[model samples]
Target: MSENGGGTARRRRRGSATVAARTGVAPNSGDILWEIFLRLPPQPSSLPRVSLVCKRWRRLAADPEFLIRFRAHHRKAPLLGLFKEYGGWVSFTPVLGAPDRIPRRRFSMRIDYGGGAETHPFHGTLLGCRHGRVLAVDPRRREVLVCDPITGDQRRVALPPEFGTCGGAHGAVLCADGDEGHVHGGCHSSPFKVVLVQISFGPGHPPPFARVYSSETGVWSDPILAAEGSRGYVDLSRPSTLIGNSLYWWLHGSYLCNMEILEFDVGRQSLAVINSLPVGDTVKSKGCIQIIQPEDGRVGFAMLSYPSLEMWDLKDDCGGGVAAWVPRKTMNLDLVPNMRVTEASIVGYAEDDDAILIKFNNNIFIVQLESMQSRKLYDCFVRHQYHPFASFYSSGSAKRKA
Candidate 1:
């Protein structure tokens, strides 16, 4: 059993004197005990479990100060796992144990919904992933759930009233709770918010609707229009990409298949369309477009054409706030001889390490940044739905530590 992000907190509320009395130490010695716990292994699988040693330990471990320090110490761990949900089966196969590799357990959501739950591993569509938590819609499509697969904690999203069907609700984003202003820890006790991207009906030119639910308020906000400046529905199937505090939607044109990128400010509850990828003269290039956060912690666009994949970073020109998209990495499939042997497609962007997940025939591979090599993880059959995601534990973790 790993450390509980917050659930393991001992409610005993022992006094400092009582704690010191139990340990046969002076009251002022509690600081020394806390200092010792500060040295606990940074592994998420250890600290919480170790806290159960005693009430005093639990108190020390759950201390916001300790959590902050603990997070700072183990902040450099890379993507520890890749979760895949396909063919009505959703499983998180541990990937962090690779000898020279990427990272988890074979954990699946065992949901218990209102004493009327679905299957052990809920057949659901994974909409978005962040902070080690996933937002998924059940197979029935009746509701959206914010789930922490590791901790088995889930909160059903509050939907907009008379919102009708889930037709236009293509994407869901989970805003986790942590500290006072930000999301930290493992999302065990932090109050969260769920935002649903549900499109509005009618022909006249209606913007996509954003149905938001806040855990603290215990209610869903009325449907609000999203991606205001752009028109036409987004490719509902494609998961929305989050960069900084804004979520982006890759909107496609109706007839000619035009592509547009729109940014939605989560805090402001507003949307603005941004520049699209520079396909240059090859606008009709047969490939897929995905928004990725590259190694430099900036939003990037990755376009896959045949055996070649090119990534472009969204950068600002020298002038004040002049937005520009710049090419960053280009990997030719020729390096991987087998890539030419069959059909391949870009799966999505791995935001944690700036790699691209690609599907070649029956297997899934991550295009590596170093050496222009590739790492293969599993064999994803045609019927399975694959969603590769990792928490914000990269170089960003160090700076984001609360």
Candidate 2:
């Protein structure tokens, strides 16, 4: 009886080991592993940590096809932080905490003027951020840089002679590959285009012109001038908004109350001005206006006046032209009894989340328009144009410190 029991116990142990080996090999299968990794949380460190699991895991995490599928599985890229430029030095403020809280220094870039006869007169200006690239202008050098904040990679595009000595140049960087099924935020390896708009105020200078630079073709298109006799200058401090195929910038007219919308149609390669203010001129003059796309996904603007926040969406006529600004919704900040609202100012808008960043009492808070939910992000003492940097960072170029 004792010998039989011993033999039975050995048989059971062999069966358990066989099952363990089968399960282990099954999880490591290409399809199974790929599916498992694709479901990982959409965070900056998600892939990096997975890569550390083993050599095979590392290779799978860095695979190009797998990376594309991983990003597509997660449509919306996570908002990592905000980029603010001061004195030619761009700094990043991390908004998320813990594993996603990228160190501010990781994304900071100090613009080098490269002392020369053609050195830029002023420091670099942070124009905008999109698809994981930050756009900045080297005015003295008469060039623009498309920089990847995550990998510290930069491609310099020399400015056209027509843009030389131009005043207040603002531009945007975007993926040049017009793939309708392509996902943005992770377009680090794709070709890109730089759309630069320069406004020259004095006579004998060309009217406001916008030029497009294509990376694939390695050339700039003919100057697309603004509408004949278009008068106004864009605020270098304000960022550009890209809605659909058009890019919008707030064009400030001669008078304080004169504010207009500057539109650059990427599809037609045309520039025009929309002369209208959704709210009263008082809010515009006070610099409380921000271009936004509400939940309904229409081009709009948000105005903040102390405790009250008003939003409006631009209605487009069937003729494919901007019709009017329709009121959307209003939120009263006074509802939060614990808050002391001394003064409020509009800082920027996060188009991905349909939220607006508001600064009040030296603190910055992101208020979502849909739910009217507000959450304090950072303690900002000074005013800076906050550019939302959202992306699905990969482990291949992971540079964040532990």
Candidate 3:
């Protein structure tokens, strides 16, 4: 991805209406053509077809600004696809087409594991995914693999201080460029932060050892302490969400039965905790959690309650009075008789849009956040999170689909 990162606006193709006016095309102006191209379905497969229409359209289709606008325009039509393990290898499937429709599983692509032709089994679990990229960890190999599933470009980073024989806590967040003191959501280079910690029990807790690695800095920071009683223990199995400058260890329950999200402010190098909705006895054993971003871009919580899914958006009261999560939407599964989700698990969270992927043992469906409507994705067995095609854009490359 070389030709990237100067913060250049090379792909911002604007002024289409003016050009069309000069060409004297009345009824269908260049602006109209441009809008049509911008409105082109964001299926990575359709862009090339639009590009083939003409050189002018090709230039607009490839423009970063246009791509960004297209995403925003269709943000409501979120559900891009699923990244799941198939036959011992991870692959991507675009089960989602346009909004308001549940398309069949038309096709899928095998994502190459760029860690060389490894004959060994990669027992790597997905840590987090965003912007068309994924961060996964192979605990056995003591390393983490960051890859762009769309392009097959990947890199490996070793675990910090090793996960050696101790109860360790770990998670990765696909954060944007937060090094410059602000969240550069689309400043371009897709960077992420990985956290590793030693879990200690009993009194004192010895400050709980921790370390972080940033893709931007390309090095692990000096060990930082997460204080004591931070959350009884960190579940490395669940992925974290990177919102603004904070990296969250989400969905952890406390002794009091309150769901919580531990905030690891990547910029301040500190830790804080936020409370989520309370758990009732009925769904206590049956429920699960997933961290997703809502329409406003704040961290949202999706709690799985057997027959229904509850969503709440977190709000921060800047004046230091009180911050709480307010209930936003609810999705009832009882409406869909075929979706007998006895053991539903959160498969994916599209932070860039309002769509989320939740799956039962064999059935998976994409739920739009706004409408809370669910649609089945045939053959989609939940899979790892991260991506809606937004992360594939880099300064050096374009889409591979035709």
By TM-score, how accurate is candidate 2?
0.82
**Sorted by TM-score, highest first, which candidate order results?**
2, 1, 3
Candidate 1 C-alpha RMSD relative to the actual structure? 9.1
Higher-TM-score candidate among 1 and 3? 1
Error of 3 at 229 (Å): 1.8
Candidate 2 — which residues are off by over 4 angstroms?
A: 1-33, 54-56, 110-123, 200-207, 254-256, 281-286, 294-298, 318-322, 334-336, 399-402
209-320 per-residue lDDT for model 2 (tens digits): 7899998999999989876534567897888888888898887767645667788899999987666665575474536888887545447887888687888877776356
The window of 10 residues in a row where model 3 has the poorest summed lDDT is: 100-109
Query: Looking at model 1, which ten-residue stretch has the lowest summed lDDT?
Result: 393-402
Q: In model 3, which regions exceed 4 Å deviation? A: 1-32, 54-56, 63-79, 85-93, 97-121, 162-167, 178-192, 201-204, 207-210, 251-259, 275-277, 292-300, 311-331, 338-348, 379-402
Tens-digit per-residue lDDT, 1-402, candidate 3: 546633333433225433433333332343576567656654545666667778887787776556555655554333445555434354455554443222212213323456445333345565555545566666566677776543445667887754552235656645554443222233334666666655554466554556787887889888777554544566655556666666776534455365556667766888655654554553453225676775453577777765778877777662586666677777676535774554566666665555666666666666777767777766544344433334322222533433
lDDT, ranked from best to worst: 2, 1, 3
Error at 21, model 3, angstroms: 18
lDDT of each residue in 187-295, candidate 1, tens digit only: 4556777776655433565666676677888887766665454544565446677777777767665532455676667788875656455765433332356777654
